[model samples]
Target: MDSTEVAKQENIQRMTSNENTAIVIDNENDAKFLMKATEMQLEKISLGKLAQQKGNSAEVKAFGKMMEDEHNASLTEIRTLAQSKSISIPTTVSEDSKDHYDDLNEETDNDFGKSYSKMMVDQHEDAIDLYEDAIEDTEDPKIKAWATKKLATLRTHLERAKQFKDKNDNLNS
Candidate 1:
């Protein structure tokens, strides 16, 4: 590889490893929060698109569309924040996320909606926890503010997912 490419790779490694002292985000926890948030966003986008195409129910499809749209917007905000902080975020979902998606994909159409709703409920709950932790733990005001701002929306999503899961379960039963 060219010297420039090598230098770039090294920089990315330092940033990702939280070893770069020159970066705006100096705290390891802040960096971890940003990276984890990015991964969640990517996974949501992937699963959302799948639901859009594979969901058997209107509610599932609509929820998927909401995930796609809202997460896409959130991702843009995250990207801008990461860029400003000189942090590198993942461009794609992780292998585990892909595996989860693949497993969800194997569900039959009749069960897909119920399974997807359950997944959403679970994911949103996890996301709420993450955001809540970030809001409490981040020392950087920008990161803290971002997390705080997103918390309510995440809560709303969680409630919606719960409602959907309940309705989906009732219908399935």
Candidate 2:
């Protein structure tokens, strides 16, 4: 082929490759977001239930109940979104989360309230960051919207967790 024709063919190939790459990246991003969100939800639910059953303080139990309820709703929303996208969510909690659960389970009742409250503070902060990242990174309008909505709730949860931690600290002092 002539030089001009060869150059044109190369440009076309590059464009096609870029388009394919974009699709693959989008799919990978969607999958990662869905899986991470699902795992977070499961961890929250499991830990929250544990707190509800074993917490020494009324406040801790209430916080745990709130976590369970909110995370369950969030889970349902994300599951629907994943289904629409044809993504499969894992049914089990991650091993890292399981280890945390085991650690919490080992704590005595007197210590459990403080330990669980502190965990809630840390986990909620992590969750808020994750949702914020999702809102910024997701190309899908539906996922972005969902993340935006969830960000506010995650912030609220974090604020509540911090309040609990501060209250516990004050009680200790």
Candidate 3:
């Protein structure tokens, strides 16, 4: 590698081992909250799966698939990040997700599509809120920065979901 690449890697290593290592969540409760946040992230991906199965439009289906792909990858990375600090994510799907799945699962394909669209909107909204709060609350510099970036992406997803919902509503009307 060139000197520039070498320097960049060194800088990253420094940051990871330095200021970025300061974790705010120290207590058992904090770990619980962090795990909860991580689970919410996973839930978004889970809901995305339902959306992918139920969506009618190519665009909605594609977006849902994209969310599933991206968040699952993100979940893997986030899991690693958390585990590096000894943070253990919940082993099961969240209770809220269980109820949500129940509520959405029984609908017919057409109704499922609509329900899925709404769920996407709600999930994106919640994701945005969680990340934004994390950006403020997390003492881990690396995690805080990650949350900030993800919050922006989640907001974009929210807008896209809203647009898709509107277009779908228009077509149905």
Listed per model in order, the count of residue pairs whose N, CA or C atoms clash below 3 Å is: 0, 0, 0
lDDT values for all models: 0.83, 0.80, 0.66
How do the residues 1-173 of candidate 3 rate in per-residue lDDT, one tens digit apiece?
A: 43223433443454455543443223233354456566766677777787777766677678778888877877776777666655555544667777887787776655666777777787778777777766776667767766776777778789988987666655542
Candidate 3 has a TM-score of: 0.75
Model 1's TM-score against the true structure: 0.86
Model 1 C-alpha lDDT per residue in residues 40-109, reported as the tens digit of each score: 8989999999999998878788999999999999999998987787666677777778898999899867
**Cα-based TM-score, every candidate:** 0.86, 0.85, 0.75
Off by over 4 Å in 1: 1-12, 15-26
Clashes of 3: 0
- Model 3 regions more than 4 Å off: 1-33
Instruction: Tell me how far the alpha carbon of residue 5 in candidate 1 is from the true structure, in angstroms, after superposition.
Output: 17
Full candidate order by lDDT, most accurate first? 1, 2, 3
Selected candidate, larger TM-score, 1 vs 3: 1
Comparing 1 and 2 on lDDT, the stronger one:
1
